[model samples]
Target: MTDDTETDSDSDSNPNQNESTDKQLISGWHGRYYEDFDVGDVYKHPFGRTVTETDNVWLTNVTMNLNPMHFNEAYAAETEFGERLVDGTFVIALAVGMSVIDVSVNATANLGYDNIRHHNPVFHGDTVFAESEVVSKRELESRDHVGIVETELRAYNQHGDLVLSLERTPMVLKRSHAEPSAAEPPGWPEGIGTQPEDC
Candidate 1:
């Protein structure tokens, strides 16, 4: 007796059935391995933050930006903006920080950013969200365990207007190949976990 059935090769393969190098992720880790990224993939970051007067002023003053347009509402009202402008560096940092869970949670280091541009002004009370798309990738020449991933990062305001855009490159460790942890994998040290004897 003989029976034949054709199976589609494009069907999803179960990791348990196949010999995959990827391992089950531990709890609290939410990042992709280098092998997971694909060109043209888009990740919409999961948070939106509203800029505040305090946020702008603190960031501006701490960074030594004495520009009145950022902290002085009265001075800004005299200008065409009609209100204080949110510092551009603060906005960029917030945008990129929101993307950490999706983009670089397991990354080694950020290489650099290029072609940074501000398209529209952000002011107090304006909410912003970020999205990134994979642009390109390459294996690092000097390193065999990591590859470089380039992405086009974009931030949009509540009204759907593009506020900023830039290209960021990060060094990512491959899922199949990564450098072994140096010490105890970056957790609690020796006697730190012990409860206080007095308590």
Candidate 2:
């Protein structure tokens, strides 16, 4: 029988130095170069965070939220489905943060979000994971170093069920020698749509 195991330079077999795999597990942005990302690309975030009852209660009260379903357990118990519920805003905020590493680590500003939906209720004990899919990439008309990128975020529970979805647009900096985009002109620029002022 022949042994075919191969050894790497950093492997434990090199006894001169003792090192652990901690460095390997350190999680952060992958820093994928500009040329690497493309439309339709999908990235799943690395970490799953477990929601706690304390988190929900704190967020609900601190935000001065008026939703009874989120805080008052007794009030919720009398409702259609009897249980304490997590705040919708908390779930959205947390889910967006969860996807930041894979979606916006190099972003300049969050342009805006569109079509946000809470597909299901997120419970206190449920664990959440996030994923993003690149929808489009367009060069800013006057900006040389940054481009607008649109992405869709989908948050799921540990059981592989989607609980929320939203689309966001952001300006992402390119890793190049070009100068950063200058601040947009003070007033609304041409060709941009506008809304009527409230009477």
Candidate 3:
């Protein structure tokens, strides 16, 4: 069997080297705010998650789903699919989780989900990818620091088959309110919290 794991050579060579360097440390992606969205813009989320039998079984069990088709192999084999099917609700949850980085990482609240539809069955070992398109956005007259943004979310299997789709509305913070410093912890003086001994 081939090992497919990737490694960074620089980090492997001198992991502590970065701590001594004076290079400006830039913040990583915190996701987009309200002004970053535009109607008709499509965001193809970069990550894909492979669903496994364990994933389906565990989620179904935890959620107290009594459906035989999801866990009982013998029962599922007798069904039309002839195999276990991943729970539909798990797929929906996974799809929404996959879209968070691009669609609602900065959202203060998820307004609601609408038009949720499951088009096909998701089976174990199927890798799922998500994409979202900005459907509409509007400023809220009642709130100056936040706005509503609607997006059409879609999920596809490894073979590019659409498995799930839905519309999500999130109340995202406006750029004016999402200041760069807002990423820092509240009420903790910046320099005072760095050393572990300070605690």
Q: Output the number of the TM-score-best candidate.
A: 3
TM-score (C-alpha) between model 1 and the true structure:
0.76
lDDT of each: 0.82, 0.76, 0.88
The lDDT, on a scale of 0 to 1, for candidate 3 is: 0.88
TM-score for predicted model 2 compared with the true structure: 0.73
Q: Taking the tens digit of each residue's C-alpha lDDT, what string does model 1 give over 49-137?
A: 99998898899999999899998789999999898899999999998898777778668899998999999999899999999999998
- Expressed as tens digits, the lDDT of each residue in 99-146 for candidate 2 is 777677667789998999988888889999998899988887798777
Tell me each candidate's TM-score: 0.76, 0.73, 0.82
**In candidate 3, residue 72 scores what lDDT?**
99
> Measured by TM-score, how close is model 3 to the native structure?
0.82
User: Candidate 3, after superposition: displacement of residue 42 in Å?
Assistant: 0.5
Ranked by TM-score, the better of candidates 1 and 2 is: 1
Q: Which regions of candidate 2 deviate over 4 angstroms?
A: 1-30, 177-199
